[model samples]
Target: MAKVIEVDPEGLRSWIGSAKRTLTIESEAMARLIQALDGPLGRAFGEAIRLIKQGSGRVIMTGMGKSGHIARKIAATLASTGTPSFFVHPAEASHGDLGMIGRDDIIIMISNSGETAELRAVLDYAKRFQVKMIGLTSRADSTLSHHADVALCLPDCREACPIGMAPTTSTMLQLAIGDALALALLEDRGFNAAQFKTFHPGGLLGAALTHVKDFMHKASQLPLVAPTTPMAEALVTMTQKSFGCLGVVDGESGELIGIFTDGDLRRHMSRDLIDLTVSDVMTRTPRTIVSDTLASEALEILNSTKITSLFVVDDKNRPVGLVHVHDLLRHGVQ
Candidate 1:
């Protein structure tokens, strides 16, 4: 048997109080950050964006300790959002990683005090190579701010830590600034979901961003028949295709006009059903989606309409493919 731990009610209350205080402090710090963005920080931010967008080479991120962790996350966000970027440790740069910095590259160096000793080599290298440097520091007059092409000064704020030493609110501000920068660049480049899917292609995010065309059954795989097609033949094709639905097309134009589903089958159930044509029971103007539609949107349509599948249509309203809810599920799309 596992040993049960005793709970201290009073201690628990104290812990909760501490947590709330921390949240309040951090929230206040973030509010100050909003004001900070409207001043010189804002101008430097715009300059950094222009440098990054204009640069032909990748963005190089470097920092030390807690700052390094935040830098890595920022680099990842930028890389995933279409801006090429990578993190290089400041210490490692002094050894040999400085070679990673080139004249065309943009360097974003993060340090709360703007005086992290490990960053000296990276700073000197950027200066020597004429690499554009964007400094993220709380001190406006620090060495980093002086040497950087653009210095984004962080708003002075209290740390959430009880000792007021550990990075808490400051790191949060850094993270928010990094996200803002990445999104600004994303919008500047007109990055879209389809382009985002190219970078994230192996998880729930990837599945959500995936286009309908990727999961759609196309060409011969579509369970299609003409409005004039015999009900018996259409039923056979629907069964053989195993899609539980059949598309009806205009024989002359080859454009989708209606769809035959299980609901229609039950509505027209009778002894003379097989003798009728597909047009006799098919539902007209069926819900459809374009190939560029996201799979996540397709799932929403399936859930909202309480249906299992949808047809992918071209600009001409011709049925190009079919996407089933099962296809979305199998690919990890919610």
Candidate 2:
């Protein structure tokens, strides 16, 4: 337990000033990272990315202490994005987890000093197993750096700790370097949002949110009326479906002729309601989206036109579905 110390504005201000000075060290370290970007280390990173892409098996990242934590995060990010990856602690690997390493796996080991005894043994064993090796570190001259098939060196940066001992800016650069590799691989693989959704399909955030067909009411579910139908009939169909609208189509080929809505009904109140036909009452070929389109697109259509619903159609101009504002909201589509 610690006692609470009395402090005032001046003490707080001095603390703020000290914190502000740390930002300068971080900035200067980031600048030094640019220099390391052009050396053999850069070539090594390119090779590591290539090896992971071309390799038939998964990627295994391992490290000790702060590096181990970073390795775990890097593994997770890579696994989520496009690559299959997992973390192995150097100490744990030394104990028994070494059995998890496979011949076809790409091994990425991270360390600031690159001389942790446990990591060195892991690297040595990995070489015998013929697993491809990638090393990340600040000191290129370290034994771990020398033994790696690919060595990624970080720029020299001052630790923000008062004694200059804690891993601060070093961790940032390590994480950033891993990000660069993962993102570079992602771009090269042409990984898009649609592909990303295949790996993550829960919480209503899947690719289904992006495609309109997943949320739109299809075929018979779509509210529609014949062109010769009365305006009153269109209102009844639209209201029953609760889509705020109805598509008017021809009897033969089901091609869209027009659309009628609550707005159309409001404007035609003075006319003889009984004599009003969809042909005389409907708006011409109202705005619509294709079945394969995104649900967010339906929201866009509604917003841009100041309407609450859109008719979804297929290639032959046949009404396929109806998408309403409520539907997008229900599906969590923004």
Candidate 3:
């Protein structure tokens, strides 16, 4: 077994100092990067966005080594944000993956040094096919910048690593540039949360973005009662629906006017309670939600009001559906 070595207090302090230094270096590099957006780099970035927006084909991202990892992440972000994108490894591109690149597609190639040998095949293929290329590199005089239709040259900055050779600040800048491009495209196209939800429809993020109507109990499943319904009958309806609450609606207009819960039942618990109508025992103007409400927001309402269920109402104030806290929890809203 490996020995459990305890770090000395002085050693721990040095470690913390190193971590802080790395953050400071990377932060400063990011600051320098934003300043370049005012100049040629900004123009190049805009051109890239326009190119992708106008193209019917997908965005192909490629890089070598650590740049490859950043390329994959950027591709995923672009794809999820409404832009069709995918990552192709440069080494693999040389070995037949280059077939994935289409003539109409725009290629965003990442390389801190701008001279990765593995990218040569991809560069040659892009040139041969007249495919537009966007180069992300720190070297303006490099071959990549010379061949690219739009060269987004990163500002010169020091690496966060002590050796100064590892990809630290450069990778951070690359990731940031990728995110900026994706968001710019998203804004240009007016992509909304509904589209985002469509792409991310399986995880906690998907659940949070899910509409209340999608998970709500509609039609016959809602625990609803007329304002004139007696408390004895309303109790049976609530029990049958198993939502722990009842929406009191008007018989003439079919609009929700009140709600009855266990708390209301306890507050009105008397020998005369059975004889009272639901209108008298219910709480008027009860908090409700719309069908378009996000599940996260619905959960927030339920928690803040300390209620387990809410009626999903329409513009007419009619109870169209019902949502329970259990339903939100079941869908991973929390």
> Which ten contiguous residues of candidate 2 have the minimum total lDDT?
200-209
lDDT tens readout by residue for model 1, 222-285: 9999999999999999999999999999988889999999888998999999999999899999
TM-scores of all predicted structures = 0.94, 0.85, 0.94
Q: In model 2, what is the error at residue 118, expressed in angstroms?
A: 2.6
Q: Candidates' lDDT values, in order?
A: 0.94, 0.83, 0.93
lDDT of 3 by residue, 244-286 (tens): 8899888899999999998888888999988989988889999
**Candidate 3 — which residues are off by over 4 angstroms?**
1-5
* 203-296: candidate 2 lDDT, tens digit per residue: 6666344777777788677888888887667677877877777888889999887888888878877758757788887899788788777665
Q: How much RMSD separates candidate 2 from the native structure? A: 3.8
Candidate 1 Cα deviation (angstroms), residue 320: 1.6
Cα distance off (Å), candidate 1, residue 317: 1.1
Question: Which ranking of candidates, highest lDDT first?
Answer: 1, 3, 2
